[model samples]
Target: MVDENAGAIITVFVLGVVTVLHLLGAVPARLVLIFGLFAVVLLLAIGLLVLGEIRDGMRDAR
Candidate 1:
C-alpha cells in the first residue's frame, strides 16, 4: 500500500505546486490542466507498475 500510494502522493504534491504556480501567474491554466492530466496518468501507471512488482516479489519470497 505504501509503495502504491507513493506515486499518488508525489502526483498530488506536484499538482499542488503547479496550481500554486498558476495562481501566481507563472503558468497558463490551459497548460497546467493539460500537463496535470499527463502527470496524473503517468504517475498512476508508474505506481501500478511498482505495486505489481512489489506484490510479485513478496509472493515469490513466500
Candidate 2:
C-alpha cells in the first residue's frame, strides 16, 4: 500500500508541475492535456496492474 501510494504521489507531483507550467504559459495546453491523459490512463493503469490492485479482466466488472 505504501509503495503504491509512493508511485501515485510521484505521478501526481509530475502532473501538478505540468499543469502549473501550463497555467503560467510555459507549457502548451495540448501538451498539458496529453500529459494528464498519459498519467491517468497509462501511468496509473500500469502501476495498479503491477501492484496487483487491478487484476486481469476486472477493470469494468463493477
Candidate 3:
C-alpha cells in the first residue's frame, strides 16, 4: 500500500526547490512558472491514473 503522505511531501519539496531556484536567479521566473504549471498538470494526470488503478484493484479484490 502506498503511503498517501509521501506524495504530498514530494510535491511540496519539488515546489519549494523550484521557488528557491527562481528567487536565486538560477532560472527565469517565466520559465519556472511555465515548467511548474506543466509539472502540476503531469502530476495530476498521474495521480488520476493511479487512483483509477487502485479503484480497479479494490473492485477486483471483492
Candidate 4:
C-alpha cells in the first residue's frame, strides 16, 4: 500500500542518516555500536513484516 511504502522510505532514510553519522564519527563509538545492534533488530522485524505481507497476499490470490 502507499502508506506502507511511505513508511519504508522514511525508515530507509533514517537508516541512511544513521549510517552516515557513524561513518563520519559524528556519533559516539559506543552509541554507534548500540545503534548497529538496533539496526539488526530493525532489519529483522522489517524482513518478517514483508514476508508476512507477501504470504497474506499470496493467500488472497488463491
Candidate 5:
C-alpha cells in the first residue's frame, strides 16, 4: 500500500521550496505558479492511485 502521509509531506516540502524560490526571485512568477499547481495535481493523482490500489487489493482479498 502506498503511504499517503509521505506523499502529502513531500508535496508540502516541494511547495515550500517553490515559494521560497519565488520570494528570492530565483524563479519567475509564472513558473512558480505552474510548479505549485503541478505539485498539487500530482499529489491528488498519487492519492487517487493509492486509493485505487487499496480498493483492488481489498477486492482481491475476498
Candidate 6:
C-alpha cells in the first residue's frame, strides 16, 4: 500500500516540476496558460487524494 502511494506521490511531484519548467519557458506552446491551469488542477487532485488517505489512516489508528 505504501509503495503504491509513494509512486503516486512521486508522479505528482514530477508533474508539478514539469509544469514549473514549462511555465518558465522551457516548453514552447501557444497555450502555456492552459497547461499551467491543467497542472494546477492535477496537483490539487493529488493533494486532496493524499489528504483523504492520511485522514483515513488516522481514523483507523484511533
TM-score, cand. 5: 0.68
Every model's Cα RMSD, please? 3.8, 6.1, 3.5, 2.7, 2.8, 4.4
Sorted by TM-score (best first), the order is 5, 3, 4, 2, 1, 6
| Model 3 regions lying over 4 Å from their true place | 1-18
* Local error of candidate 5 at residue 13 (angstroms): 4.4
What TM-score does candidate 1 reach?
Answer: 0.58
Q: Cα lDDT of all candidates, in order?
A: 0.82, 0.77, 0.76, 0.73, 0.82, 0.69
Q: lDDT of model 1 at residue 30?
A: 91
Residue-level lDDT tens digits of model 2 in 1-62? 56656777787788999999988999989988887887788566666667675454467575
| lDDT over C-alpha atoms for residue 15 of model 5 | 82
TM-score of 4: 0.61
Residue-by-residue lDDT tens digits, candidate 6, 10-58: 7656666666777798865535556556666766776788889899999
Candidate 5 ranges with C-alpha deviation above 4 Å? 1-14
1-62: candidate 5 lDDT, tens digit per residue: 34766777787787888889889989778877887888888788887888898899999999
In Å, residue 42's CA in model 6 sits off its true spot by: 0.4
Model 6 clash pairs are none
lDDT of 2 at 12: 79
Span of ten consecutive residues with least summed lDDT in model 6 = 27-36
Error of 2 at 54 (Å): 9.1
Q: lDDT for model 2, on a 0 to 1 scale?
A: 0.77
What TM-score would you give candidate 2 relative to the actual structure? Answer: 0.59
User: Which prediction has more favorable lDDT, 1 or 6?
Assistant: 1
